[model samples]
Structures are given as C-alpha cells and as structure tokens.
Target: MEYVIKGYEPADALRYFEEISAIPRGSKNEQAVAQYVYDFAKDLGLEARIDTTYWNVVVKKPASPGCEDKPAVMIQGHLDMVCEKNAGTAHDFEKDPLDLYIEDGLLKARGTTLGADNGQAVAYMMALLARNDLVHPPLECVFTSMEEIGLLGALQVDTSDLHSKYMLNVDCGPEGTVFVSCAGGLLQDISKKVRWEKAGGDTVSLQVRGLLGGHSAAMIDHEMGNSIKVMGRILHGIQKQMEVHIVSLSGGSKMNAIPRESDAVITVPAGQGDKAIEIASHIAATAKAELAASDGGLYLQCEKAGATERQMSLADSRQIIEFIFLVKNGVYTMSMEMPGLVVCSSNLGVATTDDTGVQLTDFIRSSDPTIRDHLDDEIRSLAQLLDIEIAPADPMPGWKYEAESPLRQLFMKLYKEQTGKEMVAVATHGGLECGILKDKMPDLDIIAFGPTADGAHTPDESLDLASFERTWNLILATLKALAEQ
Candidate 1:
C-alpha cells in the first residue's frame, strides 16, 4: 500500500496508523488488529502475550542500558473505534479500508470516522517499541479491545503478571489537557412487551433528523437535541389533537452516542391525516427554533405513507410515548467540587419498537458512586411505573482524583518547559480504561492525554497533525525524564 502521510516528523507513527486503519476493528471485532500488534512485538523480539479470550495484547521491552534499574512504566490504549458514518456513505466498516485524506493540516476519512481515538496511541507505542535509540525504563505496552462497547476487554483481561507502578493512558482527546479522573458508567437495557391491533386509517411517517448528536457523556451539558426524545414529544403533541396508532418506531445505534435521527410510522384517522401533518410541522418548527443554537440543522418532516396491516394498540402506543417523554436524559447533576463539570448524566441512546415490545438502551455516567446509585434507582422507578423490565450490565468503577502525584507533577513540569505553557489537569465525564486498570492494580498512578481530535464518535472526526507531533514529543520527553529518575 502507498503511504498517504508525507513530510511529517516521526513518519513511522503515521505509517502504522494508516496500516491499522485498513483492518476492521470495530468494538468486539478486534482479532486482526490485536494480532497485528502481537506480530509486531514478536518481530521485534520483545516479550509479548496475546490473550485471545479478551483480544488484549501486552508487550514488554527491556530498559535502555543506563535506565535498566528505573521503575517500569506502562502505556495503554484501546484497539477498537466507534464505527459511524454519514447517512449516504457507502463505506462498509467490516470490509472496506478507510479512505484517509489530509485537509488543512488534519487527518480525516472520507464520509466516515477516522478511528484516530486510540489508533494514534497504538501507532505511538509501536513506533517507540521498534526503536532502540530512545532512553527509557522498562516499557509495557498494553492494548485492549471492545472498549467502545463497555470496556469489556479491559474488564476481562488479566493484569497479574505485569508490574508497572505508573501508567499513561493514551485514549483522551484534547492535546494539552491531562485527565486525572473520569466518570464510571453502566448500560441500562429496558424492554416492555406490547400488543398490536389491526389498523384502519391513512398512514404518515414522522422523522426527526439533522440534529448534531454527540458523545452523550462528554457533550451532555451542551444541550444538543436528542432525536428519540424529540420524536416522542412531536408524537405526543400530534396525539393530543387526533388518535394515532404507532406502526413502528426506531432510532439511534450506539448507547454511548446521542441519537441524531429517529423516524416513526403511525396510523391516523383517514380524514384527519392533514391535521396530524399540520401538528407535526408546528412542533418541528418550535423544536428547530428552540435548538437553533446547539443543533442548527434540526429538521422534522412528516409525509404520507402506505397503510400497514397492524399497529400498536392505542393503550400501548400511549404508554410508549409517555414513557419516552418521561425518561430522564441530558445532564442530571453538576459536580459541586468541580464547577461546570457534569457529575451525573444519562442518555436515552437506542430505541426500537417491534411486534413483541419496545426496547430502550441507555448509557448512564457518574463520577460519584452515590450519584450513580441514585440515577440507577431513578431509572428503576421509571421502569416499574411503566411495567417494563430493566437490566444493568458491565458496571465499571470511577477513578478518584489524587491530590498529590509525583508523576503528574513531572508531566506538568515537562510540559511547561517544552511548550512554555501550563497543561491543564481535568476530570472528564467520559469513561476511560484507567479507572478499571486502577481498580485491578490498586497502586497504579495514571494520567491520560492525547492529541487534539474533534467530533469523536461521529462521522466528522478529525485529528490535528501538528498537535499529534507535539504530543509525541511530550511523551518522549516524559519517558526520558522518568529514565533519569
């Protein structure tokens, strides 16, 4: 394959990034990428182990001559990327290679996500491990899979053999910020059975689209519109004036991402179809005006559709609509200690309705355990009220902030000296493997930082090339400093 990145310092990093981009590594399907990392380690004669059960790889390289006695440090990142694309893109993530291109000093994929979130981290580690010139202590490079789904690989991987006192998680977003703490989260799956009845009316399809949905945990406070909730509101408003039965309802794909588009098929009284369309149009206009600043492209369209044989019963339809509108979403609570940071939040991410029932999946996040418990209770209470079954899965622990860390101070001091500016230390609402790894290794001191990447978990994702080089330099400098210690 021809190289796409040219005239860049540390060309090997970009090369490896592009190479990895060719493989299909979305969430649970990470065998090829994990094997690539394992093979690379073996080719370099490094000590490596690949856990096929969880698809995690751990590679260790001995310290340099002068730094052999220095304490070992681990660098970690996930191997999977969130597979998102534009509505009309023809790319298949399972088989097609990413069409990467350079634009205005940033790297992006054509009509799809660039997968740079953790790919760059993997590239950086690979580059460092292949080179013997860098002065650093014994290095442990760890890569886990299925992180986008719920940090499954990290949760299942065994860390008993490794002994790294300090860890650098290379899965964060912003270039100049070091994340010391992150929110713990879990997936809540709610389902309710429904009975269908024969339909006797004209059909209309209602759609809510063009909303700028984002990562539910990071952008919850941004007030971006949730399409599932918005569609429920519009349906409820139409139901107020006319009797409509739901034929089908579906929206959103991933639980971690906010729903951007939703559509529903409903049956209305043959003669009252015009009135229902009018009501839907009015609600769409109002919603557009309300979310203009955050989701400027918000649009709602209602159109005539062919009649369906069966529709949800009026009672079941009403129950589903009411439950959707009542479900809690967006920022639930703000942190008292950290101003402007969301302490607790939940996203009504994936929704679908079928003959058997309606199912809704949500990803709830909280930095405080008590707040997490409260949010769980709130969801359970709502489920009980609606007579739906709710199940929580893969609950992960949160990483608490440490006030005094010599490693953090070292990175801060090094960053100041290199850039002549201070790097910000922050607590993020997004889930990170650092929390799980810390729990597994209680004495591990960890910090997460990465190059600037915008529009993560979306089709518009891009990586800043210059920022990537600078972050690479910072990591090299930090490793060198640790060796000197």
Candidate 2:
C-alpha cells in the first residue's frame, strides 16, 4: 500500500500508521494486525507472543545498552478499532482498507473512521520498538484486541509474561490532558418476545436519518438525537391518532455508538397511511428542533412499502415503542468532585424487531460504584415490569485516580517542561481498558494520554497530523527521561 503520510518527523511512525491502517482491524477481527505486530517484533529479534485465546499480541524490547537496570515499563494500547462509516459510504470494514486522506492538516478516512483512537498507539509503539536511537527502559507492548466493543481482550488476555508495575496507556484522545480515571460500564442485550399477526392496512417505511450520532459515553451530554428513540417517539405519537402495526424495526450497528439512524416498517389503517405519516412528521419536527445544536441534521423520511402479510400486534408494537421512548438513557448524574464531568449515564444504543421479538442493546457508564449499582437496578426493574428478557450481568469497575502515580507525575512534569503548559489530570465518563487492566494487575501504575483526535467512534474521526508527531515526541522524551533514572 502506498503511504499518504509522507514527511512526518518519525518516518517509521507514519509508515507503520499507513501500513496498519490497511489491515482492516475492526473489533474481534484483529488476527491479521495482531500477527503483524508479532512478526514486526520477531523480525526485530525481540521477544514477542500472541495470546492464543484472544489473539492479544505482546512484545518486549530490552532496555537500551546502558539502561538495563531500570524497571520494565509497559506501553499499552488496543489493536482493534471501532469500524463506523457514513450511511451512504460504500466502504466495507470486513476487507476494504481505509481510504486515508488529508484536509487542513488533519488526517481522515473518507466516509469512514480513521482508526487513530488506538491505531496511532500501534504506530508510535512500533516505531519506538524498532528504533535503536531512542533511550528507554525495558519495554513491553501489549496489543489487546476487541477493545472497541468492550475491554474483552484486556479482560481475557493472559498478562503473566508482563512484569511491568508501571505503564503508559496510549488510548486517550486529547493531547495535553492525561486521563487518570474513567467510568465503569455495563453492556446489556434486552429482548421482548412477540408473535406476528395478520393486519389489513397500507404499509409505509419510516426512517430516522441524518442525526450526528457519536460515542455514547463521550457525547451523551451533548444530547445528540438517538435515531432509535426518535423513531420510537414518532411511532408512539402516530399510534395516538390512528391504528398502527409494526412489520419490522431496526437501527444502529455498534452497541457503544449512539445510533444515527433507524428504520421502521409499519401498517397504518387502510386509507389512513397519509395521516400516520403526517403525525410522524409533527413528532419529528419537535425532535429536530431539540436536536439542532448537537445533531442538527436529523431527518425523518417516510415512503411507501411493498405488501407484507403479517405484522406485530398493536399491543406488541406499542409496548416496544413505548419502552424505547421511556428507557433510561443519556446522563443521569453529574460529579460534584469534578466540575463539568458526568459521573453516570446510559445509552440506548441499538434496537431490532424481527419475527421472534424486539431486541435492544444498551450501555451504562458510571465512575461511582453505588451509582452504577443503582442504575443497573433501575434497568432490571424496568425490564421486569415489561417482562423483557435481560440477562443479569456484573458491572465492570471504574479506574480510580490514585494519589501516588509516578507515571502521571512524570508525564505532567515532562509535558510542562517541554510545552510550558500544565498537563491536567482528569476523569472521564468514557470507558477504557485501563480499568480492566488495573483491576487485574492491582499494583500496575498507569496513566493514559494521546494526540488530538476528535469524533471518536464515528466516521468523522480525525487525527491532527502535527499533534500526532508532537505527542510522539513527548512519548520519546518521557522514555528518555525514564531511562536516565
């Protein structure tokens, strides 16, 4: 593959960035990229292994000639990326390489995510491990898979080979702010069983589209319009004025991404399809206004559909739509400890209605354990009331900011000295693998930071080219500072 990122300061970093970007490393399909990491280390004559169960790659580069005695430091990042694209984009995540492009000094993938959320970590770590000029302690790079869905790889991977008590996590999206703590989260799949029945009516397809859906945890406070909820609201409202029976309902691709669009095919009373659509338009108008600031491009499109013999009974359809509209979603609590930080939230991420039933997926996030428990209880109660089948699950614990983190202090010191700006330590509502890794490796000191990237977990995701190289320099400087210790 030809590299579009020429002239970057560290030639190897840009080269590896372009190389890995071509591998198609969507969550759970990281085999090829994991192998690439292993082979890269093997070719360098370093210790490398891929965990058989989850395909997590771990490689060790020994300390520089003079820094052999320094403590082993692990640089960690996930190998998988959240594959998202615009609705009309023709790119396929299963096999097609990302089409990289540059605009205004920012690197982006045409109509698809750039994969820089953690891919840059891969490039940066690979460059560091491959270079002999950089001074650093023994380095362990843990490339875990399936981080985009959940921290499954980090949770399942064997870390016994790693002896590092301290780590630099390269997964944050900001440049100067170092993430010290992150919210815990629970992923749930909920279902409501149903039976189809014959309905005599005109069919119409109602689609909620053009909403700027984003990462559920990061942008929950933005109040972005969730197409699922918007469609539910339209259906719920339409039913108030006329009889409606749903044929099929579906929306969203990833359970962690707020849905940008949803489609519902339904039967309106014979000769009353026009009225139902009018009501849907009225309801959608309110939603569009409410969503103008964050998800302004919201659209509710309706069209005639071919004949369908069966549809869900109005009782089943109403229950499904009402539940979606009334579900616990968006931010629930704010942090008194950290101003402007959301402490607890949930996203109603996906919904599908088919021959068997309606299934919905949601993610609940919180930094406080008690709040997480309370929210879980609320979901359980809601599901029980509706007779919905939601399997019981445990909440993954959040990472708490430690008072004594030398790694955080080191980065802050180096960042201030290098850039003359304070590198603030912060907590986030977003979930990170650090929580799982820190929970498993109890004594592992960790801090996460990265280059400036935006619209993460969405097709609009972009990496600042200059900021990417700047952060790479910071990582190298920190490595040098640590080697001198």
Candidate number with greatest TM-score = 1
lDDT (C-alpha) at residue 454 in model 2: 97
Write candidate 1's Cα lDDT for 1-485 as tens digits: 77777654554688889989998789988999999999999999999999988899999999989898888999999999999999999999998889899999999999999999889899999988988888999999999999988788989878888888899999986987898888888789988888888887989999898998998877899989999999988889988888878899999998989999999999988888888889998988898999988887989888988878999888888878877888889999897666788988999999998669788888889877788888888888977887777875657887877777788999989989989998999999988899899889979889999999999889899999899889989999999999998
lDDT digits (tens) for residues 1-485 of candidate 2: 56776664554786888899999999989999999999999999999999767989999999999999988888999999999999999998999999999999999999999999899999988998889888999999889999977788988877777888788899996899999888988878899888789867899999999998998877889989889988888988988888778899999988779999899999988888888888888889888898777788998899777789899888878778778878888899997767788888988888887679889998888877788888888887877776777877777878866678888899899999889999888988888888888877879888899999999899999999889988998999888888897
TM-score of each: 0.77, 0.74
**TM-score of candidate 2 against the unseen true structure:** 0.74
Q: After superposition, how far is residue 268 of candidate 1 from its true place, in Å?
A: 7.6
How far out, in Å, is residue 483 in model 2?
5.6
For model 2, the superposed segments whose C-alpha errors exceed 4 Å read 1-47, 61-71, 79-120, 123-138, 146-152, 198-211, 234-248, 260-318, 367-370, 392-404, 426-428, 452-473, 480-485
| Top model number, lDDT | 1
RMSD of 1: 5.0
Q: All candidates' lDDT scores?
A: 0.88, 0.87
**Model 2's lDDT to the true fold?**
0.87
Candidate 2: which pairs clash?
none
